[model samples]
Target: MLYSEKVMEHFTNPRNVGEIPDADGVGEVGNAKCGDIMKMYLKIDNGIVTDCKFKTFGCGAAIATSSAATEMIKGQPIETVMKLTNKAVIDSLDGLPAQKLHCSVLAEQAVKAALSDYYTKNGIDPAPILGEIGECAHCAQ
Candidate 1:
């Protein structure tokens, strides 16, 4: 499938591609059917996302989405980051193939998962905010 110039750029040179040893929050999600996995790291300070990073084991689309997701959330307030969606990530990359769209979903979920972890660590009930962090049903389809 053909990818956008932005997608190719990120696939070749993914940003925030590493782990934060002292991350305030960490989240991991995977699609066993496709063998794609994503791990996200976040550092929050005073309700703002100070930093973000990720490690993705999957296709170019997955890597690109992860890169875009981190860049979008970094330096933003937690409230803003929480509103992030797969559509936003996909749009940021110009777009993704219909089949590869699942990657974008994974990216969104990963970020929310990290935020949930952050809230939980801080003694807050993430369930009330993040809802349910579930696997990508589209990936399984």
Candidate 2:
């Protein structure tokens, strides 16, 4: 497979690859078909995402997608981050192989899952914010 230059860059040097000791919210998602697991950590302060991190155990596309997703949401308001989509992530990486499109879906789900967790932690129902995780049966989210 021919990978985009941007994909290679992010995969080789992933950003925000770590953990947040006092994370406000955390999400873990796995691709049932491939067993590609992704864990996302978020630190929200005053309705803004102060920081974001992730750990993905999968292919180069997975790592690159997660890295781009985190970079996209960091320092942005929670509302904006909520609007982040798989297409956006894919575009940010200059595109992924057709088979690896699911990686972008995982990245988007992982972030939403984390935001849902954040809402739950703050005593707010995630349904309004995230429309409930696992709503999509195909991706199990």
Best by TM-score: 1
Error of 2 at 66 (Å): 0.3
- Estimate TM-scores for all models: 0.96, 0.92
On a 0 to 100 scale, what is the lDDT of residue 119 in model 1?
A: 95
- Candidate 2 residues lying further than 4 Å off, grouped into runs, are 31-33, 135-141
Compared to the true structure, candidate 2 yields what TM-score? 0.92
Where does the lowest 10-residue lDDT sum fall in candidate 2?
A: 132-141
Q: What is the lDDT of residue 53 in candidate 1?
A: 95
Kindly list the per-residue Cα lDDT of model 2 for residues 1-141, writing each as its tens digit.
988999999999999999998999999997546668899999999989999999999889889999999999999998899999999999998888888888888899999999988888889999876775553243554
Clash pairs, model 1 backbone: none
| Backbone clashes, each candidate | 0, 2
State residue 72's C-alpha deviation in candidate 2, in Å: 0.3
Off by over 4 Å in 1: none
